[model samples]
Target: MSILIALKQQTDFTSTEQRIGHYILAHLNQLPTVLIKDLAAKTYTSHSAIIRLAQKLGFHGFRDFQRALTTEIVTQEQQAATVDANFPFSASDSVTTISQKMASLTINAIQTAQQQLDTTQLAPAADLLARANRIFIFSQGDSQLRARSFQNKLVKINRFALIAEEYADEAWNAANLTSKDCALIISYAGTTKIHQQFVAYFYEHKVPVIVLTGNPQSPLIDQATYHLLTVQDEYNFAKIGTFASQAAFEYVLDSLFAVMYAQDFHNHLQDLQQKQQLIQNGPLTTK
Candidate 1:
């Protein structure tokens, strides 16, 4: 598990341990320079408590944990710095160079997503979708566009999925959701007011919600019944256009679709083939 995952799963930790975890999360960059004793003092805890937390996180000790964290911080900073949202190339660069950089950035994003994604979460999400009466999808902007693509995939398998792009539509769909329905929400920042409002409605209605987000510390984390994370480290200005975020979202959605499709693989495939055959053969006419 990553450092963020460790902190997210700190329910079993003691109060001191939880405090130390939160401190480390909030001040990740300073881990390289801060001493164990200083960290303990800051958290109002002892050195042993700090060491124990590190050990629990699979580090040898506080120093070892700090070293790993420093590496993570530096690597993230470097990747973020290299990203170019505007041109992704300089005036001197050729088209070939620009293409290579774009490919490299996209491939790297997918690989990082593969490594960071927790496969353990996929199975339960698949099971929920497989059993759901209908799937309600909530998202905005680029993420919503990706949700529409996933909704198309689900339609091919004869699964009912509704992608609500507007707030009123999302609220209407969510309000009508029953226990047998599921919600899949996609957001990069995970702090959108509209997303939160609909998520709250789903929570109150006892509807299972699956959220895909880039921010682990997002408020959607707690609201989601199943939360899948994606890292968009390839983008410098994330707001410009969601190249990496859209790629990661599609990758995750494809994985979920695969798992759900595998539950009744043959039947779904046959159904899809039959539908294709009907379309190819043309629509029926009145006799």
Candidate 2:
């Protein structure tokens, strides 16, 4: 469980400790660098009471608590920016205001994804994709659009991808895949029945499955060979749009493409330049 979630659910604390917790929650952006003395002074509590609050939340002390809190704060900085993922802008805002809010939301979402993903998971995920005989992406709706974008990027490196769910032929595509292939599943909620069936098939067949999802407790998490989690601030089905989720998906997919390209950096670059040259100055009418 995330420390942030635990902190929010705590119900048993002394008055002084409660005050300290409330202050930290209210000023999350500044809590990382805040001194214990200053925090206690602001909360009107003693330093010992603040330490007790941290310990109650399962940290060793104030410093330990602050460290974990900082990791979760990467996404919570939205609070400081006043950008709500569900409703970033009011209806009364001007045209430019909505545009600016979206720009900031995109940056925040990518930053959250970066904090959530680590090299330990990305390196192996890219390696699996690079070595797979074929890559199939499983997604639908907005996530399907992101999958198509990733499919296009992979082609530049000579890695072809198929949309497994395209044209309602998902069952046919699944039946055709073998253990040598890799399945890349993209979903925000990760609870669809069809996706679960896909995961089960891949798991039983010894095929590699790479799951990208925001839900940590998703049913699709257990059997995946590589679980790449990227949580955004978007709600389950009630938001202006999938602004944060799609941006995070693009960043994760781009990161995988970059790492795979670097595996054969010189050769990929040479191939790309050669292709550009032929397309630009070929004997056939280029345009």
Candidate 3:
């Protein structure tokens, strides 16, 4: 786990420790240079409390923790300067400025998603999708669009996929899912009641489930057999659109598709060549 994530998800911290951790999280830019005594005074704790938190983080002392945090800050501070995910542009902005801001926002979102990935989980998720007899995507709203695009890519690679909720057939799809099938769920908040119920059903049936989500505290995370994450700082209902979350989702999907392709790289290339020839010469050709 990254230091930041560990801090965000700290569950076993004592009351004093939680205050210190919360302070550090809220003031990350200042934490690197904050003295232990100063932090203690600010959080109404003592220097020993700070040292204890540092030790829990596996650092020898407060200074070591600061040094590690400083290193993380140096590498992880590269966000788009003026682009906001919620409202990336305004009516006053020219067309060129709008286009450029959108591009920068996308680049920053994708880069941040990459930083949040737990690479060890990636390969296993790909393997689950590859080995499943069938793949079903469980998503709704704008996220379903990303799932559809992913479904199309899988089709190209000769791996068929189904959007489980297409035409409101979620229950039907869930009823038909077997242990041999795999579920790929995409949700930003990951708190939908129906999804929770469906995941429980999949769990009871011993089906493999993979969820790609932005929320760190999502209960779906614990239910998943394998998972991928694309955490982005975007609101659920207040955003202009699902710009940052969608970009992050696209990055993760593209990565998974690339990995699945690499698993049979030579065979996929040959298949592509054959498909190209068929498109060129077969009666279905448009050229």
Tens digit of per-residue lDDT, candidate 3, span 1-287 = 45677688775889888888899989998887788778988999999999998899779998998998887666556563557788999999999999999998899888778877766778889989999999999999999999999999998889999999998999999889999999999998999899999999989899999999888788998889977777676788887999999998999999999999999999999999899888889765897
TM-score between model 2 and native = 0.78
Shift in Å, residue 51, candidate 3: 10
Report the CA-based lDDT of candidate 2 relative to the real structure: 0.85
Off by over 4 Å in 2: 1-65, 78-81
* lDDT (tens digit, per residue) of candidate 2 on 55-162: 887789999989988877764664436688888899899999999988888888887787667567788999999999999999999999999999999999999999
Ranking by lDDT, best first?
A: 3, 2, 1
**Every model: Cα RMSD to truth:** 4.8, 6.4, 3.6
Better of 1 and 2 by lDDT: 2
Angstrom error of the Cα, residue 188, model 1: value is 0.6
Structure candidate 1, residue pairs in collision: none
The models' CA-based lDDT, in order, is: 0.79, 0.85, 0.87
**lDDT digits (tens) for residues 62-178 of candidate 1:** 889888777766766665566553345667978999788777667656765775687677889888988898888888888888888898888877787887665566667777888
By TM-score, the candidates rank as: 3, 2, 1
